[model samples]
Target: MRVIAVWSIKGGVGKTTAAVNLAALAAREGARALLWDLDPQGGASFLLRVSPRRKASPRRLARRSVELRRMVRATDVPNLDLLPSDLTYRTLELELNARKSPSRRLAVKLTPLDGHYDWVVLDCAPSVTLVSEAVLHAADDLLVPVIPSALSLRTLEQTRRFIAQTRSKAVRVLPFLSMVDRRRRLHREGCERFAGGAEGFLRTIVPMSSIVERAAEARLPLFAVAPSSRATRAFASLWQEVREQSASPTD
Candidate 1:
């Protein structure tokens, strides 16, 4: 399975939104997709209308006492499953650090799910913690949602440097602009600067829209709520780019 992590060290960059929409789009295209909500806040789980069960203990999950598959729950979307996140996941870093090869723990846990899923979309928490490190090691592609701003661009560069420091040749970093408002001069300038598809940045720019916010309130992906919306089309284009890139041989 191709593991795509929707992550950023900085929060509120539309990471969870991208994760849910991309996963939904993958499932819509008949791919068996699992959305693993790794954020302790459970944004993706809540957005998907899946509640976290009390049975999921952070230590047990980290130690493999409880199998990953057992925590998998089906969502309303066909072919889309969810591994719900719990508040206890806040302590998952400690548990993972207590284990050997902590950076590879998540990848090892996902091994058994290889044949069952075509795509595993990870909704990651915003931080550079042990959990984030594990995600960096586990994921085949890092889908970073960057707002069109100087700080967001800096964060994206930091993420690229982090990946380079890991020397992980297998994982690719795909950064895309999110919450872009063309009315704002900075937003328009940022889009024009990075939208050229240079330095591996995605060409798709997700615009700020009330329809996207409505999808969260409606507890559904934008594709299910308003497929024809500009935001939804942007996400669809982003998914298409991701699919094409994932299929190509690693450089």
Candidate 2:
């Protein structure tokens, strides 16, 4: 399965929103998709209206004592399953650090699901830790949502440097503008300056919209609530680009 992680070093850049929509879109297109909620806050899980059957203990997960497949729960959306997260995941770093080859643990855990899923979308928490490093090792693609601001752009560069430091040559980083309000001069300028396919930035721009918030509040994907909304359309375009890139031969 192609693992796609929607992550960023900073929070509130629409990571969970993008993860939910992207996985939903993948399932809508007939791909067997799994959305793993790696955030302790359970934003993706809450958005999907899924609760874990038991507390996701970091110790069990790190030791491989728990079968990931057994944790999988089918969502209301067809062909889309969810691996819910709980507060216990906050201790994941400690558990992983106690193990050998912690960075590879996540990838090893995912190996069993390769035959069952076409795409696995990870909704990651915002931080740089052992867990994030594990994600870097496991993901084939890192989808970063960058807000239209100088600081956000700088954070994107930092993320690049972090990946370089990890020497993760196989993982492709795809950054895209998110929550952009075109009416603001800074937002427009930032979009114009960096949205032009520079530094592997994506062409799709997800505008700031109340409909996105509404969809979250309604606990449904944007497409399911407002398929014709601008934000929904933007996510659709983003998914199309992601799909094409995944199908292309990697360098």
RMSD of each: 1.1, 1.1
Q: Write the per-residue lDDT of candidate 1 for residues 1-251, one digit (tens) a residue.
A: 99999999999999999999999999999999999999999999999999866777788788755679988999999999999886878999999999998988998899899999999999999898888888988899999998889899999989888887776547888999899999999999988888678768899999999998899999999988897999999999999999998999877
Tell me how far the alpha carbon of residue 188 in candidate 1 is from the true structure, in angstroms, after superposition. Answer: 0.9
What C-alpha lDDT values do all the predictions have? 0.91, 0.91
Residue 223, model 2: Cα distance from true site in angstroms: 0.7
Could you give me the TM-score of model 2 versus the true structure? 0.97
Q: RMSD, model 1, all Cα superposed?
A: 1.1
Q: What TM-score, computed on C-alpha atoms, does each candidate reach?
A: 0.97, 0.97
What stretches of model 1 exceed 4 Å from their correct place?
A: none
Task: Give the alpha carbon lDDT tens digit for every residue of 41-146 in model 2.
Answer: 9999999999877645667777776788887899999999999887878988999899898999898899989999999999999999889999999999999999
| Cα error of candidate 2 at position 84, Å | 0.7
Clashing pairs in 2: none
